[model samples]
Target: MALRTGPGSPGPGAAARLVVVGTACVLLAACSPPAPPQVPAPAPSTESAGPTTVEPTADPWADVSDFVPGLVTWDSALPEQSVEGDPVEISLGEGEDPVGSFRRTNVGLSFEASDLADERWEPGTSSLTPLIAALNQPSLRFGGNAVDRRVWWTSSDESAPDWAEFTIGPDDLDRIARFAEATDASVTLVLPLGHFDPERAADMAAHAERALGDRLVAVAFGNEPNGFHHQSQLDLALRDEGWDAEAWVGEAEDYGQAVHDRVPELAVDGPGAYDAPWWRAFGEAEIENKVALSQHWYPLWSCPDRSGETEERAEPEVENLTSQWLHERAETVFGQGKDTADNYDLPLWIEETGPTSCPGTNDSSRTHAQTLWTADFVMIGAAVGAQRMNHHSSLAACRGGAPMSMVCGMGAVPNESPRVIAQSNYLALLMLSQVGTGELVEISSSDPEVRAYAVAGEGYTDIVLVDTGEPGTDRAMDLSVDADRLHGISTLTAESLEATNEGRLRLLSEADAVPDSLPRGSVTLLRFSDE
Candidate 1:
């Protein structure tokens, strides 16, 4: 007497139980509601959930396709929307020819050499290892302002000049070397040029090579040497005047010559300057010892002190992270380096760069704005013809730490556990690693806010969409790709753009593969694979 209504009235096992219950109810004469009118059992259909009238309306893609849940949507296509017949068209060539490969260490970390000297690294085991190793492949370069200001390089003899305040010994070098191996990263050792000593240079290079072996990629001679003249400290200043590109070239040549004289096989990268004139001069000089030309950069600075000649930048702000000016500034400045590198036939490396210079725990440097900026900035580096880039990092206290550090530790360098913590912006580095090493493809977008970058690999293509618009702003993109080539789609996004220790990653592909409101101030990675 129990009315059963569903896709299937009842299975055999279910019917058996129902029969037993009905018999007991009848015997007791207590069947509820006097048993409703008998109804026929509905047969189950395997072909479809039998036709139930569905109401539909103006949504064109309502019945187009079911959106595969999660980050991946396989065997499907996204509905492309057009803003008045204008949509961002992305063109991926036949996967055979690639302009160039975006190598494994294309995106890396830059650290001040003094950090190593400070014993901040606890090689083999540290909270920093997991995050770095997660990138699969990365490079860590130790060199920065501290190298000239306070740090000194001591080789086997363990010697330092009278002016040297702190010395980086074999122990420190070994610590960073061990860390690089632990994190599966390459090492680039930077030696100070403020006081050039050929013997010291060779000794440091030899020590780095012995400790790092093939893992040692480059022995850089300087860190933003162009700006050394601006250092207010009397001891830090390399030259009072006539410290131009030609002068840097001569000094770099001298350092390069000394290092190679003792360690001929060691690769050298140099002239780490924020300005481009040094790059031109170094390239023009054709410094034979140089394997790559590097430049350190920070679009803006939080520090109040600066040289009178240098133009004053607008105050460092979180909003500036995604500003058009930032991107243009990077392109314009790095474009010069790229041109010189190409002219000289050497690779251009952005050895030091981040959200800002010495942010010292600035809120803007640790926020989601930095995360989004990282996406835009890394792509800009790629587009600007940079062979590789190192985003600067620091664990020193905010006062000593730098701007745009991926993770900032509460305790000073050499702090114990519970003090080292990652910033929310680290999501940016994790996101960049997803693309891995692949050939970059061409993308054409009218709207710059939703920047598009595609990486073509063996049997797959990764498309990274960086939307820098605000939360309430409309950042919908009519992404055009070879739909037929899309076998599966994998994309991940954070729950919210605000600061949160706990990261919540979710898929944002719309049911029809088209959404009016994509997550603002977020990065979306889509992988199209043959499998």
Candidate 2:
């Protein structure tokens, strides 16, 4: 617009102004303004925002370690299964009776006297020694078929044969006395009832008293008269014995009464049967303090279809049946009775019991698991208040069959030795013995797979835990204690769930090392020091 200015000033100045304006325009054009490049709003995280979510993986059996302490009882025959020098150290509660292995009944190993003699009996403190030592077992019932065949009592034979000649002779009594002297065990003898000779039965009792003297506990009058009728039928068939049930029962009562009159303090027990008839009969007869009630238990009767054929193949249904049978029998017999501790009262003893009667058969009691189950039975029986239990085991050699042996069957077979070889039952006894003697305390846990029992002793509290769940299932448990009562803990576990042999008893040294997890199908004993 100012084109007509001074020739040099206006023209030059105007030109400079135009150059400046052109430079500013060029700079503005070169500096292209960055246009907003679009970015799709980060696809809403498929996962909800805040904290990164993590899905839990599939985990079954997360809480299977809970358990509760149950009742406990003692099987008097346990010590008889021990090796002599291996004297098991049992812990009894303070102020409790110092009870050791006491023989509650006497039943010879199902072998003849000659067979036992030829087995080369040993004299040291070993398993065999204990068996021989327990020969003086008191309150015995010698009326069974095997007893009639094996024992040569003076009543059966007028020779008044000593125990050396009989299945349990003077030599056996001497050994028992020595064992008692060493291990503090007592004796209970049950006289035989199969033949039912009162005079003969009394003579046998007199013979036992003469040999064992005051050491004798009591005499059991009959084998199992209540079930005698039924059992005799089967037993007679097995032994080819022409037995008359009615005649036998009458003879049994007479013999028992005779023994009762002769030895009132001998503490007799009887009607060792599964049914309530025996208890009712014994009560009705008014045997009073002179007699205690005795019973036999076989959680499983070895029927052809239900025999425990093999370790892995045995049916648990059979075991369940056995348990149910015992439980029902206990209720019927012990529950229906009167409450007084006098004339109308009688204490119950599980005189004879086991997994099977014919432990030597193909379907015999050879499995380790069977022994574990046996332990379960024993614990249950104790919980229910069965006074005492005697597991039927052979104390001598067997007399017949291939692969036939004591460890395999309930009956003693040929070539079987009583050196305390590992058997399912023996292992089970060991586990029970470890619990010692005490009033069973209470323990409870949430996991169904775990079962436990606590026993309080003078300086220790024993806790037994059994895991009955599937193999490899890990169980986590919270173990609480009476902080005021206990101080330290020691644990023992069955190293291998399938191991029924001696190796199953593995004592763990780390007392306070609570396991973060436990293997399936195991039993753990935790001892808490009272100090």
Candidate 3:
């Protein structure tokens, strides 16, 4: 049977395929004939057992309603695991409401430049269009570390090397603009600053501005210049010329100014940094002309370079993928960006981030855990006052290339494949997009395993609870709200944290609702309305 890959399935992208394949291999192994049992002589210690029987244990949740798969159970009358028999109170009215709106651009996506020029992107037939619509975000960024070496396919006569990757031209940009129009999303094209061709970049930028018109948000220069080889190469180039952080600034200024001079309407975003030192320095120099402070972040090395091979990386470790760890990392990185943005009076944009860098992880990045992690990461980013959080994916995976990282390419089905599978992370983003803009009020949970946040929408409140625990860990939160009624309780879950079932967002009414007892390794959202 053909594998139906995508967001909710066992993963259609290369990375998810790897996980699925690995699991299949294990299952295949189990189906094979077992070796002859090497039974040791019976131990002299114990008396012979009657059929080696095992004792039956009481089911703690038997009296409680059985958890129906794909149903939101929201009954506060259920028993609370804590002492005093009360749900853990999440105090919301005490603190000043942190009011903010979630913009269409707030949940953005970053991809390779080549994806913009692919033929498969044709509006009516392409599988990527629906996926893009599901995001419902206002901005889409075309660039990654790939921009460091990307060439503009300027001429048909320019026969490039097999390894060479190229970006779109005016015609390609027009096609992409149509895509943006279809999805109601804008485009942010990152120039090839690593190539350092101001004239060429300016020409491309000008053409893009004309093609995309108001759909263009901003053009960033390069990807992570500081952490990648781009910076090292620039350092070497500076040996002959004046070299310093200002040198980078001067180069960016020249490139950006050239493009700006031609496409005055397009804003320039830059000095994409991955760390505090680089961001602080880059922000200091580029803050004047830049519209936003762009940066990249990964909790730890998702790719092999920072560690070893994909299989060797520990990104999937349940201990590390916990809510506490992810939340802490978000605080640290977002805090730094927030500080820089505050210091320079600029909006901070996390232009690139994922479960890891380089390529995506297998079991870790492709599992249910990532879905929960993504929910918390995005909400935390919004709460931290970030202007936008752009999830990074590659063209290869989207087009059914190879599996790379947790934020694997989103195309789901392989290129030219009949069906487009949505990866798990994409589904997670789709669920997140449903959260309407409002003040992300504070959610306090006494239990560390459970993390909660509330969006105080004018007359409604959206409560999100994530359980980052091993399977069988029971959790519920007593969310005290002033609303007269609560509705739209839903949960995103899978058979196991590692299972790639594509899960789903199941809606439940008050009768079907179970008090915030979110299943282990899942995310639950509750809507409370004054009406």
lDDT of 2 by residue, 1-531 (tens): 000111222111112211112111101111111221222112111111221111111111011001001112211111111111111111222122211111112112222223322332334534444432222221222234455434655423246333323454445445544544432234456665554467766766776666555555456665555444454245443222344444444566677667666754445666566655555555555343344566675544534443234332222333332233444444444333322213455555566666554444443334444545555555555544444566655444323332222233223643344334334444444445445344454444334344445554434445565555433333322233332322323232333344323223332222233333334455656544433
Number of backbone clashes in candidate 1: 1
Instruction: Tell how far residue 144 is off in model 2, in angstroms.
Output: 5.4
Give candidate 2's total backbone clashes: 37
CA shift of 36, model 1, Å: 57
Q: Encode model 3's per-residue lDDT on 102-208: one tens digit a residue.
A: 44456778877766666655665655665565565435788875666655545234565464566456778788877777766767788876666777778878877
Q: Give the Cα RMSD of candidate 3.
A: 18.6
Ranked by lDDT, top first: 1, 3, 2
lDDT of each: 0.58, 0.40, 0.56
Better candidate number, 2 or 3, judged by TM-score: 3
Q: Ten residues in a row with the worst lDDT in model 3? A: 22-31
Could you arrange the candidates by TM-score from highest to lowest? 3, 1, 2
